[model samples]
Target chain A: MPLLSALGGATWRLSGHLARHFSQTARRGERPGGEELSRLRLDDLAPTALSAGRLELLFGLSPCLLALRAARRRVARLLLQAGKSGVQGERAELLRAAEVRGIPVLRPRRQKLDALCRHQVHQGVCMEVSPLRPRPWTEAGEAKPGDDPQQLWLILEGLQDPRNLGAVLRSAYFLGVDKVITSRRNSCLLTPVVSKASAGAMEVMDVFFTDHLAGLLQAKTQQGWLVAGTVGCPRPEIPGSSEIPITSCLEFLWDQPTLLVLGNEGSGLSPEVQASCQLLLSILPGRQLPPGLESLNVSVAAGILLHSICSQRKGFPEEKKRGQHL
Target chain B: MPLLSALGGATWRLSGHLARHFSQTARRGERPGGEELSRLRLDDLAPTALSAGRLELLFGLSPCLLALRAARRRVARLLLQAGKSGVQGERAELLRAAEVRGIPVLRPRRQKLDALCRHQVHQGVCMEVSPLRPRPWTEAGEAKPGDDPQQLWLILEGLQDPRNLGAVLRSAYFLGVDKVITSRRNSCLLTPVVSKASAGAMEVMDVFFTDHLAGLLQAKTQQGWLVAGTVGCPRPEIPGSSEIPITSCLEFLWDQPTLLVLGNEGSGLSPEVQASCQLLLSILPGRQLPPGLESLNVSVAAGILLHSICSQRKGFPEEKKRGQHL
Candidate 1:
């Protein structure tokens, strides 16, 4: 008993120490474990002394090799996290390719890695090369036109945590979302933390960064998109009270360019964003969702929402193949 | 951009200094933000000078309130961190609560409170009262039995980080997981930091602690239970192949006592637990299912796995009623 409480107390003190340390390190623009190496800024990282090679992040050694082969003409630098050295002979071969390309390999020290990128478990390796710049919104129509029935886009409003942002991005990719957009001021960039968390999804997704979210959303709405803001309160159109029936939501997706908007983790979607949207959908909190537990981690909430959406789209075909159990 | 990064860096340094200061104070077992007080080991905290009508913990109003509520039966002393008064209605009410209970509210001199609480987020009060007893495994079992179809449990295997454990617990409760079971040696207990992150779920949850997990698990299996370890490569019967519908896998739960086991966040589940389990499940990563991004935050992974299990149980019926879109 007393021993347990004391241990508990010590644990609290240790975490506070750690969180405070990381928060401070982040503010100083230095890695956590590094001794103030340089008073450098993000601007200091600009293409300066040399054109650091354009690195493309791969989900695993296999994709990395394929990517290395496809983009061999443009390759300059290849980097992998030290922790992820377990891939088969292929990863070793990629290392050999880097050796052949005369590309300098950079492995970030674990403890010093930025918490955001480090928290996402990026399999230890991320490329720092300039990525394929996302196509302009107009050109983004190539994959699935704004009018396509199967298209899905994730809209984030005031999600402050980078881990949450990264997880949301990863979830978006897993469920086959076409694109992700966030308010630049309150959102995180496709940093190493977000990249790692996304499990290299950052390398592939069409992530649009902007400060003018309201304007961009307004344009999206004008293009015949049905924007639904997930909120705290229940609405008739929202499927299950506690859990959304994503299949139903997806049925409406083919007929409409669907934009699923989620609000901040602390507060639900803002009223300003809510009022401008076509519908306000919510996952009811059981028969009676308590006020404190009402809020869900933005990423967890996004997973449920995206899963519901995908289940509706994909689960439909399966249901038809096999008659309903119930 | 440079200016912003510089400013951010400054904030990080300042935060680090504060964290260090707190850490040193904690080592000495002093109150938060107070001068060097006497050092006390874990054993010294037992029967810590409790007096009737008084609660003496380093100052902060929040702790005062919590202690008051926790020690309603015989709280005798109220110790406020020095120079921590004259806030507003909420803080002022803290004093009133102590006075109403006839607790001898003592105002420690400036820095004394800091020394006592090791200078963390004291919020104004600390108390000396009866220790919190560990809820037995049987009691935890009754909170939500392992066999309940709706019940969700997080069985952690050798997870070392308190923050990750705390985050997973918070995710479990928010995502409707019934309880979290962890080996006593390998896990951290419910502490102030965890309690804060959990947003009070710790108080409500029945966290079962065990010293021998393998033995406990053996007992569970003896009762005809199913253990699903979240590891193992793709198997035809496993859901990792995507060929195994989530609904079918989950339907197996109706008649069996099911346990969803989670392993170390960075490392995969240990071979012992994996070998002992009846079935092993893995989240298929990618459109084609790749490797690196295959790993997920234990908490995030826990949320997804629990969601997958619960969804299959609850979602199938709901889907049938809505009628298949196909």
Candidate 2:
């Protein structure tokens, strides 16, 4: 009973229906159309379904629920595991949202749902929704010299990992970043995996993209915005690196509108992008690091750097107002 | 040629051997014992192989390399992909370490290597090594009142996710935490996945474990070490609250020995554990969070909190002696 309670009463009711359905399918020696559905791949559905504007199969409870709530994309169908009549909480809310929007809700077998999501942990929910695309930087408006000093925008150049991108977005949104821009050229797009990895932050945040990252940095610099590129622990051994002055992230005060640039996971910021920055920021390790363990994960680094900069914002709690000091 | 150079000269040499192996296997209508090896599972060999002290199949280039370098456990065997004779760089280093240890190395098919690691990017290497067990808290030694003023130990209580544990270890090591202790009960173990997720930090860092987390906290508190527990955004609306005064992590100065406690992912610190804290630490969000987007990922929070606390340690660069202020 405690297990049932932990699982929730709705699951208890749904279990009976699921059991009955499984037994019925087994007895029939066929799963009706379930077998065919379970083998369906996203690529196979690309030509027709995606062309019809249902671009992605967004899965997971948080992503699906948030996607529906955000209403940024059109939800063509909501796929719930068979026998959800007794479902409650978020799943029930998802169903209601679909109903309010007149989106068709389908009760498919769990196998079919699994196949639709490429066997991701969907939590008994998936949706056929339009892709959430990043807007161009041109639409992000010009940065004037008199812009808010506390404004911070995160620029990701050539980040290839979807999970890292998602984690960065989650941190950016949570840390109150004014805008997020990624290099359109070698950046991971806003895929469903990214949505799940972000814990659904991707559903709410508006990300901008640009093919010309270095140009944007130069333009922002000319517009009186500080462009700070992140580099790992100072590699003074590298030739021709002494020109750019790198400051410890903690020592660098955020007193003006700034663009913080993060680079690719494998190879860091390309030379052209690094050259466009007016300043270079680096996180100093508390102790000497082992050979291969020199740098922090990009997402973790982003979180630390963003927290350091954003905490210095004008209205941050208990800091400027409360006169608290470390 | 450029692609081959980027992949390394060893890969170029290994390609012909791999092509020959694949073609030979295809012509033979068999995989030459690889079929059975590919089907092998850890549980299937637990009764015999583990009883003989071969415990875990540590995979990934980093973990395998670090495990070999650390020599912490008795490595039973090292399995490299069949065509690795032509491999250089880290792979060559790994082979040299194995040879130095006099450990047997097997040249298995890539499919078998994949199966050994459950298909989680083994990078053409796998190792059958003894388990890396956490030491008891008793072995961690007592915290004297006159102990180093800047000592910081990360205490993880009931952390369930392997990846989170790994990420925390990676951050803890990178940030230079003095020691890491975790609750033995209801915690994820140091599995291969954890090792891989940690970027091989688990192979090098010595983690301590305790059955009674609260007891250890109380004992450490009595020894003049501050026990600080992390909490989410303050809930002024909780019915029976207000005893613990949570300080902003940024505002909390780390001038003494401290134990930073992080709770589980879903349900945070258990009630009993929360009561054992001398102080509570909370990271202030930069802006108002929407519903369900309240907290940061645990590992990211760990990195931020650890960096904040660790940055204040005595002799930290650019902080104490440099006279730099944010």
Candidate 3:
């Protein structure tokens, strides 16, 4: 998160963006309403000290409290609404944890906290902590042989919804995904709402940020890794749509080191991203509804796909599998 | 919707509730804050009128537009924001359709529209249409034998969020479920927010309402329907934990007449509701996530389960099945 640290692998441009983000987020309540504020670039935030690393502010009770108690990164400060004197239950435990850690707890006015979170659901709490740094994309090359499971990485291309991205992260981590890679263009970054949506999965998930996503995917394909992209079926009953030849989640190859690409929420995969995919996969609709009625929400699709892929990888005894009514 | 039609099945109890709704929604800007108003029940609604079987006043562009285009039931009146004629594109088309149908169009001021919607997101349009009537539970018995696919019904118990209920409805209709039944207690009813979230699925979906939901579920069980309830597993990797013998969704019996019951978003199935389910099933975690690191959002989970069950019902070519990835 510091300018110097990012210089190690990422270009100076990313560092400048990070510097700007700290400044923008620090200037609380600069805007009257913040639907636009949550979708801010790193440059928007005001600069804060990154003694341990880049300082990022996280909001809402779950993320803040989770970060305070469980995050490996340093929780630099805790922010609470003024005159609240700390809430009961989980909130009280958060305050206690902050006290135990000697972290400063600021009881700022509700308006200030509201502005900081851009009027999103903060539930009257926030936190400043070390930035969650993604492992270098190049690290995949240096992995020791046989050290990891068949690598499964998720490449999110142009996912606009922060919550969707967060939900995917939760599923990805839960399903034992090796890493998550976000395409630099048109992806929601680590925002407070995204953190809350993940229910703290944001803190521990292994993530990789990269530019030139299509090119990188192409390179990975050349290296013999299967690059599978998700193509949403408007009607699952009709699997072989006009645009792409799609395999159901049940058919997706599990033995290979694979990279699954999820595209923008509205549009399916971009032409470039789709070209990089060795196979295209989708969730087949079971019961045919009216035309255009069977489209699955993207995050739900991700969960189903992840479950399917993960279960194949961990082939436990068939007896524990119970009766297969399918 | 002509008022005379509603004179059929609904008791005076519903009319009294409808009357209350009109007055409450009309008291816009009445609440010092609108959060409480937004969460009010139908019984809490201030009453208006049911003339000629029409119960008017819906909100948001999609529901109003969708109502005009596809709604089978009566859509009595369309309300556009004042000073803004139904402009080009979808809104304009909606206006033309209403004109062709001889439905009156009123352009109320935006402020009044906001008040009527309780400051919820209306997107500058509202419609006054008769509320969707729920098919009686006895109608399930009258369902023609062997004509439809093995019947699948969703029974929602105690869902608090209107958006979640609406989302479940969208998935239900999309996945080709036969009927949706909601407990009269604690479930968010069909509201404008719900309609918008469903993208207008609320208008056409077959819904049944029952006051004694537990009793009805029991009766359905007695009638030889396999009532399956969803039980959330915090750790899917370690199932059969003291609670119930949970089966994977893949193992869910699709051949039987099934009624899947989903419980409150926060809590799993209640004791009484769980009692009705002959089988408790869940989507197992494919990978072992850290403790408390993995819980699927209820709606996302719903989409996944629905797709899984639906896909199995419509088995395609065995060759296309492409080897069990799971």
Best candidate, DockQ: 2
Of the two candidates 1 and 3, the one with more favorable lDDT, higher being better, is 3
Q: Highest lDDT among the candidates is held by which one?
A: 2
Give candidate 2 misplaced runs (Cα > 4 Å). Answer: A1-51, A81-89, A108-119, A236-239, A318-326, B1-51, B81-89, B108-115, B235-241, B318-326
B278 in model 1: Cα distance from truth in Å? 3.4
Candidate with the larger TM-score of 1 and 2: 2
Q: What is the TM-score (0 to 1) of candidate 3?
A: 0.71
Give the proportion of true interface contacts each model preserves, from 0 to 1.
0.11, 0.43, 0.36
- The sequence of per-residue lDDT tens digits that candidate 1 reaches over residues A1-326 is 21112111111112333345445656778643332323322221212212343222322343355445545224444546556556557667777878887765655444322321323333454343444333335444533344366667888887766556667877777656778777656655454445445555666667775566666667777776767667644433423322332233223344456788888866666555666566555332222233345444567667766655654454332322211112
| Candidate 1, residue B163: lDDT | 44
DockQ of predicted model 2? 0.28
Q: Give the per-residue lDDT of model 3 (tens digit) for B156-268.
A: 88876766677778777766777888887777767666776675777777788888888987877776777777866633433343344567786665776778888887677
Model 2 lDDT, full chain set: 0.75
After superposing candidate 1, which stretches have Cα over 4 Å from the reference?
A1-94, A106-139, A142-147, A233-256, A286-291, A315-326, B1-151, B161-163, B188-191, B231-257, B281-286, B308-326
- Which numbered prediction scores highest in TM-score against the true structure? 2
lDDT scores for all predictions? 0.51, 0.75, 0.65
What DockQ does predicted model 3 obtain?
0.23
